[model samples]
Target: MKIYADNAATTKMSPAAVQVMIRCMEEDYGNPSSLYTIGQKAKETLELAREDVAAVINASPREIYFTSGGSEADNQALLTAAQIGKKKGKMHIISSAFEHHAILHTLQRLEKDGFEVTLLDVHEDGLVRPEELEAAIREDTCLVTIMYANNEIGTIQPIAEIGAICRAHQVLFHTDAVQAVGHLPIDVEAENIDMLSASGHKFHGPKGAGFLYVKKGIPVTNLIEGGAQERGKRAGTENVPAIAAMTEALKEAVANLEANTKRQLEIRNRLIEGILEIPHTALNGDAVKRLPGNANFCFEGIEGESLLLLLDDKGISASSGSACTSGSLDPSHVLLAIGRVHDVAHGSLRLSMDAATTDEEVEYLIQSVKEVVEYLRGFSPIWRDLMNGKKEFIL
Candidate 1:
């Protein structure tokens, strides 16, 4: 049925967001940097957008710094934290092993810059223990960065608990909430978060737009030194159209988040239940402590690429761990971090739904997955022996 089940990676932009972008392109195209009337109107619109984004996270508009996307926001947050830390002789940063590449690679670069990093491990269900983070905090630890929700397995971290720990330690706390925004509730003040990152595309907003929230009074060096924009925190001309669209999308997405969450949970549960009915299958993450729309599973005796291709043939769009790491023959770091072995991790598939997903589509996906897994396993010698109840011995 041509179903698209990769909402975790990105979702189709909502019609309201597109309408706002169209209006901005057609009428509000003036440069916000200029001093003319048109520029003033554009500037006002940008400020309103900032307020909308801030309201979504319960932060002041002055704290919001728009960026190109989630990756840039993540880089800015981590780098800014490191810079602030250096001023106080605090150079150590702590993050979980299951964070997105945006955070993981940023920390890797910080390591090259001679900063110490501690990558905490996740449990088998893809959850980092709050105590582990509390234990990781130290006198020289400047920042504790954790993801609000996992991109692959759909596990939601205890962000409030972790943030409280960082607050108690008087250390800065940052969360990559790209996947969590629009799907879950977030209050920076209530969570005691010092910084947060989010992307537009993750929440049905336009791509090429995002924002980083830096709490008031946090000292951060400018990442881009150019025309004074975003209160001298971010530089370059503002993208009025995209930013406007992002604000509209965030408002709409967060307005009915509770209802959307209930619907998504229904679809995810149905999909997971159907998949578990298939023999030799296992779910990849925590059943209860996960995002509403995430349903990841692993099938024995089948390569994830083969399964994805077969599903594609059935007009069902989905994702595979191996497909995401197509060039690298390595399994997903998140899966491995959550205690999955390389072989099992290679057979994983991530099926994320959205508010637009239908029950029939979920059913179709479940049936398609069953046929594909059975077809792939049928050809395996291991399956043949197991079916025949044959004896086996291995070194």
Candidate 2:
């Protein structure tokens, strides 16, 4: 009866990706930086992987630069864009408030270093309007960064329209596509994206592997120091095995995108419909524009952590918010950004499915959540207060 519904946090790597990693680890362990024959072989493997990853997004192979993971890719994108902006005497940057901490925190640091930032608020649907972005841009605005899809709530942004606006303004655009890259189709050129970031582990690939897409001819400064690796943009001994396996996983994901997305959407909507049947429970994010696999909800009078613990006991894996910040006691910044009250936001739960999710598993999740919410609410003082006519204190 074990059901895993936290694919948004990370997914089990496919067998094919695993085998390729093992083969590379055992049989092809040469340094790609060397001039020898074995090194040349490793270099070829790396380039082939690069080509595969690039093709998924219709990007040129030269535009893709490998990174340790999404966070590093995000940092490189922001820092490099900031440096380029400084050179041109532009200092204002724009992003949405619901963005993952990778982009939010990076922008915060940039602000302290004297880069002014404008964080636009998202609608209750967990989406930022494209018009807001256009209005926020100024003559000195350097970069406009937004996520392709939100990690916690799964709200897909208007990246194509936003990209078009940035292009018209001659401002650099970057998107943190960690949650959307392999799960959804992306075309850097058609979208007018100047830069983008993605992580492999989000799409059933191994951890510690990712890439940043910097459109060719865009100015970018190096984040990592030393060496001429990654065309001197990212300097390190290339991780040939992980990069190869990641591309293989991306290839599999992209090839089966339509089927996989449809399957995930079915299970996600089913769970969403069943979960919202409980009184005082509300779905988070947009009902129609969310990721195919994400279904988040907030149940009044229940702490998300307590619910997660009970679900774990029932062998159902889930999350209250981003796995990165789940340890914190604060309510989700995303929920707050979308106008959720503190008490309700603290009770949010995120159940992200995958292509392999089964109907039975989803039904079990629905029943278990119903039981858990009822049980928790029975002991909640807030619920009792509301029942006893204490509405004024509920908020």
Candidate 3:
């Protein structure tokens, strides 16, 4: 049986979402920018979508700006914040080392352009301490950007506490909630977040559709310059169909968030418990503070790539790190930032489930992982030496 456990990277588009998208593509194919009757219908659909997305985060419809995806939204947040706050002599931006590259690389580019960046370190459990974040804020710090939950390790940061600190410092706060939106509850108002980013695909919606929430009155420069679209904040013709489908998907995902969270927590715990029962295996993130659907761990004396290939052969899909950076040979920066040594980092695996995941599937994965780890460890000289209590073998 095929088991898909990589929901953190992206989920299969829900049937409901697909149906809505198809209807829009076939019947409602009109430019929202046009003033014709069909265009008016499309524009209405788009407006309703905005309301749905806004409802999920408890933000007003006008505060949300649709973007191509999470990357663009993140870029818009950082660049806009930095640009608007430049004249205030507060060019420094603070973020954790475990942020998605969307935030990390953008901050790196800003640094190259003479902006100061403070990359706060994460604890061994892959969590950034709120106190550490508060300490990192400075007079020249324009914005504080952090992820709601890590994509690889599944560690949920203390975003509410961090946001409160930023509020007290009077600094703009942004969070890349790409992984946290549908998986967990988020209230921009309660968290005091000035800006937030999320991707549709992350929550079973179509790809290439996302939104950025910018609190009203926060001045941000437009990332794209063109004819007035997205109220002149984002450029190009709005993708009405994808936006509508995304709204439906978001509503469905969040409607039963409590039930889904409970189910995922049960499945995730079973998977983690099963994996920990295996020898020489260790969990990679905080047990209590993580996404309910995420389970990341490392198997000593085995390579993550090898394990992934084995699992794939068994019809199980998984990942070693962020799907965006999985092709690179270098280890994940997020893993390294959490103080994992190269060897442990190299052996890491991330297994994230979703609302559709089943108990049988989890059991199958647990069994498959056990067999693969045993098979791999049998060939490892380190395992053999340790088993024999012989540690003096010279290379």
Candidate 4:
């Protein structure tokens, strides 16, 4: 048993990535900032890692700047882009309501500091229309930040089209691609993206490692000051070993993208189909355009946390929404943005798979979910009410 479908929260590091990290830690253990021979070796390893990460996204190595992780990368991108915008006399920025809290919270800070923010609403499919984005732009709007893929419902946005629109409007476009970067193909040039953010752990790399891709010639103020590290954009000594391992992981993910996507999609479909067979249940997000590994759904009467606890007893790992917001009892903002009412949103489950998922795991997950939902509903007063001719609590 022990099925883990919460890859969207984080993933187990690949053995190859772990070995690379260990090698770097033991053999190339030198400060990249030092001028000694060992330091030079570490520096070379760091540069090589940079090149590998850049190649995965088809970007120049100089365009990539290592960061602490996705949240830091996202914060850096938004803050710098906003500062650049302020210099050009454009204080208004645009984003969607479904963004990870990393982007949204940063924008919230900017909003209080005199930046105008417009948060667009997504359709029930959890996608923002490119036309809607175009209409949201104004003469003073300088940056448009959108995510490449939603972490909650696994809905992939129209990033290419959105990037194109931002280009036409001469606005800086940034995407929080933490969930999509290694899992999907992302050519910054082809997509017209001015800036992007990604995390290593999202793709089987070590935690606490990530990068921000800022297209060359784009004006960006340094978020971290004091050193020449990362071309003077990011400060402090680099985590050379983790960066090396992250690059290896990204390379492996990109190299196997096609095969992995197909396999994950197969399992995702099975989960979706089987889960929907449950009465008083329905799938969340777009059926066809979601991430290959994501299958989210809503039950009519049960609470998400209770169901998750029951699944855990059966050796299954899943999530109600973003792991970042797991401690909060509030319904998912993404679900609410997609028109889910409070009760329906509260009963949601997000089962995100990975390349390592198997057919047996998918089958077990479907059946375990069925048993959990039925069991929970048996004790749910809301379910009993709906069954006895009171439909008010039904989602």
Candidate 5:
């Protein structure tokens, strides 16, 4: 069937984005930093793209800073907040335990440099508690960075509530909204977000394109130093073509968000229902609070790696967890954080649908998964032991 179900990893660029990219590359091929007529046209395209991207999140064009992608944006956001906090004598940061590696690894580096980080527990539902986050803030806490939506388990955090609490406490709030930006509606001002990060490829835009949103008066510093591009905060020849394509993609996504959400939700819920019909299977996150196209499950008595390989052989593309960490041999940290033990966590499957996914495709996926799990379990010694009651079933 050649089903590609891993939309959380990335998506195919839309035709509108491709056309905009081609137009920019072919006709508007001038440096936005140059001071000539051609360059002026390119610069105009860049600024208009900035405005379009800003409008998607209800942000001002001046507040948006282009970047290579989500990782750079995340690093810059953290660096900016940490530097600002350092000057103000605050060195503590708060985040959730299940955040993407971009945020988690940066927090680790910051910890080495004398910043205290508190990663609140995401309970079995994979949702952070707003009260706990509010209680974690202190006089020394300067930033509370949480992801708007999880990349693996697909849990959508209570960003509005968390942002309100951070604002009440006079702390800066940042969210890595890489997975939520185009899929979900975001209003940075209304959400009280002080800083935000987004990537392009997550929503049918080309990769290597993204932007960081910093509320005015937050003083952004250069993550790279050179020319005075990106308001002197990001120094490089601006990628005008990528930026324009990304902006077009964002605008299209926002325009069709309601209809796409409705369609994907139906497929996602059906996938969940069909998959859970298997014995000893369980969903990983809050069903209703997750992204419309995401469904993660842990099937007892099978290995995730083998499941993926077999599914691939069946012409279906899927993942056990985050694509960024797919090479690792260890089980997913996000699944573990949600209280899944190692055995169950190792048997996980993540099927992320998209607007193109159809009900027939989802039905094929359900049947294929059922057959694969049953076949894998037939020869697994672990399954044998569980069936014989030598080892207890977790899921």
Candidate 6:
């Protein structure tokens, strides 16, 4: 049952995205920088893609700037906002503790450069409280950057509320919406967003393709400095083919967003319910507020690496947490932020199913996970310790 349950890592590109990419590669291969006809054609394609992406988020086409992916977009947004705030004598920034490393590491760098950053606590439910965020804001708060949805636990943040708070305080708000872009309905204007970062691969588009939404009038700092492409903000030749592919993918995903969310929710809940039936297993994040396709859990015994390997043997691909940090022996920081102990955090599994996931596949996943966990626990000394009352059970 070779079920690919790790959509959070990256999704298989949709047929439409692939077709568009191929067509662009073959027919629109010219550099958008040239003044020739072929180059102009490629340029048109690029603008069209930008327009489509902007439309999906209720943003102006002029406000969208293409980038390598979410990480670059995040860097651009944070730095640009910081620059803007610095001119106004604001140096403090606010964000949540559980933000993606792209945002967190950038914050760390800014900290070294004399910026004070306050990371609000995301409660055990993995949701950041807007009031807490508001309270953390200071007169010098330049930016309030938070993720629209968590990458590991999949808890959807209250972006609109957070944005409103930032707007009321006249601070720039940035959201890393890489995981929430096409999967969730987004209206940047209605949500009071000043900047947004999204990656294409998260929504079944080609990797290395994404865009940053900087509200009109906000200057974007160049992450890549070279040619005058991307309005002279992003240097180098534009990736026309990948950009076209991502646009089509984003459109397709948004066109069916409601139906996809509903279907995925049903499948995800079923999977979660079945997994919870296993003793000493607990679901991470708020059950109702999480993404439709994300179901994360921590078992009391056994390591997540062993569980992932065994699940792979069963043809069920999953993860312990973010794919970026999968190679690390350290447990997921997300789980730790949510108050999961080291032992429990090490036993985590994250199953992210896409809209196309099937019930039969989910059933196989349930059975396979149950078998693997039970099998690992059977031989685990930690399980024996918990059973014999030598170690206390946390979950």
Reference-based lDDT, each prediction? 0.88, 0.93, 0.90, 0.93, 0.94, 0.94
TM-score of each: 0.96, 0.99, 0.97, 0.98, 0.99, 0.99
Per-residue alpha-carbon lDDT of candidate 3 for residues 1-395, written as tens digits (9 for 90 to 100): 99999999999998999999999999789999889989988999999899989999999999999999899999999998999778788889999888999999999999998899999999988898899888888888999999999999889999899989999999999999999998899999999999999999999999999999999998767989998988888889999889988888899999879999999999999999999998778888899899999999887777888899999999999999999988787888888898877766777889999867888888999999999989988898766776787753211
Better of 4 and 6 by TM-score: 6
Model 5 local distance difference test score: 0.94
Summarize candidate 5's per-residue lDDT along 118-184 as a digit string, tens digits. 9999999999999999889999998999999999999999999999999999999999999999999
Writing each residue's lDDT as its tens digit, candidate 6 over 1-395 gives 79999999999999999999999999999999899999999999999999999999999999999999999999999999888888999999999889999999999999998999998888999999998998899999999999999999999999999989989999999999999999999999999999999999999999999999999998889988899988999999999999999999999999999999999999999999999999999999999999999999999988999999999999988999999999899999899888888999999999999978878888989999999999999999999999999999988
| Alpha carbon deviation, residue 37, candidate 3 (Å) | 0.2
Q: lDDT, candidate 2, residue 101? A: 91
For model 4, residues 1-395, the per-residue Cα lDDT tens digits are: 99888999999999999999999999999999989999999999999999989888889999999998999999999988888888888999999999999999999999999999999999999999999999999999989999999999999999999999999999999999999988888999999999999999999999999999999987667877888999888889999999999999999998899999999999999999999999999888899888899999999988999999999999999999999999799999999999999988999999999978878888899999999999999999888888997776444
Backbone clash count for every predicted candidate, in the order shown:
0, 0, 0, 0, 0, 0
What is the alpha-carbon lDDT of model 6 when measured against the actual structure? 0.94
Question: Which lDDT value does model 6 have at 42?
Answer: 99
Q: Stretches of candidate 1 above 4 Å error? A: 322-327, 381-395
For candidate 2, what is the TM-score? 0.99
- Superposition-based RMSD of candidate 3 using all C-alpha atoms, in angstroms: 2.1
Model 2 off-target regions past 4 Å? 392-395
